[model samples]
Target: MIKKIFLAIIILISLTNSVNASTTSNYAEPVQTISKTYTEGFYKFDNKNDVDIGVTLITNTPTKIMILDENMNVQFISLIPYNTKFYLRNIAPKKIIAIIGDGEVALSFDKI
Candidate 1:
């Protein structure tokens, strides 16, 4: 009786392993994909320039600021508080022709 029970257990385990082997062989495991993820309030800057960019905001003008493109065309204009840090939306510091504002600011750049 004990020998019969042992044989049945072995058969059950073998059957389970065979079923798992068939499944594993027939369907490959899901491949993990690598992708880029941007966090909230994170911005993607332009990184195709090879020159040192110096973005400086000159004070003693006005609260409203105007950012111009490389061709001197006005792209964006906004009001900024005095002596406060503000971010340029959808504008690359290096691509800007000029900034008309009131406050000293230094823009930093990083390679992506």
Candidate 2:
């Protein structure tokens, strides 16, 4: 009976470790980075990948960000504050635009 209990505990520990490993493996660093300074206009990013992606935006001044579809319809929009990191997940393969008022912005893209 003691031998059986020990075997069960070992199995449980192995299973737990495997689950943790798989989750950590899915995390990844940024694949692309774009930095730009704008006074008044827009910057576009084309996500050509078939799968959805993730986006992180860091700005030196308050800025507006938008995700647009193929037909130029806005899907998502937000105004991020200055000196902040904003993350957007599950962004479809489409166009992303950043509309700036007057400052610098840095953007990072990665696969989800």
Candidate 3:
């Protein structure tokens, strides 16, 4: 009888320790991702000489901010983070249009 009780207590303690060892959080479920639309347009900077069109790009992904010339050639690529502003250097007839946020916000700067 003594051995049986001791074995049962040991099993309960082991189960309790196993349950306590798990460190997962009992929180809400993860958020779902959905497709969002964004607007992009021409932008000019003061200190730089490139026309830029800003767009919503995935942060830290394989994606990059592409700079194009008037002839639609790839001029430069900026590895900026999400919601970051960058000035493209050394180009012609430039303007600055900011398209940002998950909700597709548009901002226009008259100069720079």
Candidate 3 residue-wise lDDT, 15-72, digit = tens: 4345445574211112112223333322323423333333445443422344433333
**lDDT score of model 1?**
0.39
Candidate 1 regions with alpha-carbon error over 4 angstroms: 1-64, 92-94, 110-112
lDDT of 2 by residue, 47-79 (tens): 555334333334466555655554445566566
**Candidate 3 clash figure, as a count:** 6
- Per-candidate TM-scores read 0.34, 0.50, 0.30
| Tens digits of lDDT, candidate 1, 1-112 | 5575457445534643464456553212221222222121112234454333333333544434444444334455454454455554444543432223334545544332
Q: Which window of 10 residues has the lowest lDDT sum in candidate 1?
A: 33-42
lDDT of each: 0.39, 0.49, 0.36
Can you list the residue pairs that collide in candidate 3?
A: 43-95, 43-96, 44-95, 44-96, 49-91, 51-94
* Each prediction's RMSD to truth: 26.7, 18.6, 23.2
TM-score rank order? 2, 1, 3
Clashing pairs in 1: none
